[model samples]
Target: MVSETVSVSVPGNVDLAGDLEVPPSSRGVVLFAHGSGSSRHSPRNRAVAEALRRNGWGTLLMDLLTEDEERSDALSGQFRFDIELLGERTAIAVDWLAKHPSTSGLPVHVFGASTGAAAALVAAAERPDRVVSVVSRGGRPDLAGGAVGRVRVPVLLLVGGRDEHVLDLNRKAAEELPETHRVQVVPGASHLFEEPGALEQVAAAARDWFLQSAGSGPG
Candidate 1:
């Protein structure tokens, strides 16, 4: 069950756009922090979200950028690289989910792709008490700057084999993270991992990691 029509509006602030799906036996909720020029409508992220839902996990796919911000960033490409802005917006989404009636009180996980991965780490670092775990798919975790060291939650950074550059970056980022986290390199996959069964592996790795870290201390 994918709730394509479902979304969230924060009111006073520009309402964040998203697709929410809650499974009957959802163990926790995973929120998506899309990378540059992307939104909840991203087919790749949506595919992984749906896979998560099938495993009895709830999912929140949200666009961290506002319409105006998104438009400006598309042209300037500045906002996307500004880790602080993306991190703040990602944190807002986490806070909203934690307080919402449908998803309130549930443990939270942030799934970040590409640049979004770094944003997720920043959000997790800022709100360790609320966010339980993190999963980065072909993420640029290093872009989060020094925040990676302060992240208390267990982080799983997934990288593609063919994407050597990202894989190297993720490896380097893992060194900065505390010993509680890990970096998983998937073979035969690249940045987007559009090859057959590659994204599914990313989703599965993320699912297992999130499930393991759900209630664990500092995970």
Candidate 2:
């Protein structure tokens, strides 16, 4: 596999840092949108990315916010909840992926965590033809507002069984989605899926969903 630290340019001359990994003859690529207050360096997301790479999928873990924006949000906690801005950035990342030489021909999938899931849904709605599938991990898909119903591709919502509130929200969001959507609960897991084998299960489910929906299997 070849892994590189890359920069993605968005509107307003802003560049977001990303870690991109592409394995030999990868069947597809998955872009990761991290939760609020998290970045491309998130351990859980990285673990999931590694698992996907092992399954012959490439991964791009990128920060939605620039360093300055992140610092400002740290002080004011404002930008993290700006779902519109986040969604736009996610869409920009998708555009970048479409132009990237290594990943352009492959199908695109998105894996979003927490609030990032909302942004991912909005991006999918905007680029219905480009995005093949989406997976949310303990996400606040309800926060996506009306955009949730606009997503045309298959969606998989993974939540922790013990996380009652998020589970309810996932159910409500799933209702707004099309019949291709599904909600899977991780037994004995919490919001972060920090329990033993919980994150692995999330990765496995995400991998299967992407492979099936995108028609990309092991290389």
Candidate 3:
């Protein structure tokens, strides 16, 4: 059964911002970090949430950008380019989720799309105990640069075959990551995987990775 979605406002840079989703008696909680101007309302991330909830895993799809930041980006397009700020916001949300009653004891995983992937990796590096693993889809993980090496969590990088640019970036990021992680390029898909059946493969691959890495509670 799916637990109701609740607003667990996190103290962001300014006023609090964030939302958490928990599945009933969930095996674990996966936090979603939306990139650029996206927020908790992103359809793609929401779709992934539905899939994860069905698979018995809870989801916390938080917005990396606040309302003001979103407006600023709409005007100047700067938020997506600032990985550090995005990473900081992601870290704060993860910390909040760690303390949220509904998610406190569960394994925490961060699933990032686009630039949020870099932020997720940085958070994993910063809070190893809170974030046990990471999964990236159509992500610009390379944007995280040298931070990948510092992450203790096992990371699974997923890129679409047709998205050559992002695929190459993930390939390079994989080399920087520890040998324990895995990287896969889903066949017959683009960055958005708008193509039929492509996104399904990515979702399945990520689910397996998150479940495998979710140990018996936090380390």
In terms of lDDT, the best-performing candidate is 2
In order, candidate lDDTs are 0.86, 0.92, 0.80
lDDT of 2 by residue, 9-61 (tens): 88898989999999999978999999899999999999999999999999999
Q: What tens digits encode model 1's per-residue C-alpha lDDT throughout 1-219?
A: 435544455545666777788877678899999999788889999899889888888899898777898999989997889999889888888888888766886788999999999999999999988899999999999899989999988889898989999988999889988847888888999788899999899889999998889769443
Alpha-carbon lDDT of model 2 = 0.92
* Candidate 1 pairs with clashing backbones: none
What would the per-residue lDDT of candidate 3 be over residues 1-219, giving only the tens digit for each residue? 434555544454264345566768898888888877778888878878778888888888776666787899999998887888778777887887778788878888899988889999988878877888899988988888677888888888888888898888898888888736877888888888778877677778878988888763343
What would the TM-scores of all predictions be? 0.93, 0.96, 0.92
Clashing pairs in 3: none
Error of 3 at 100 (Å): 0.8
Worst ten-residue run, lDDT, model 3? 8-17
Ranking by lDDT: 2, 1, 3
Stretches of candidate 3 off by over 4 Å are 1-13, 216-219
- Each prediction's Cα RMSD? 2.0, 2.4, 2.0
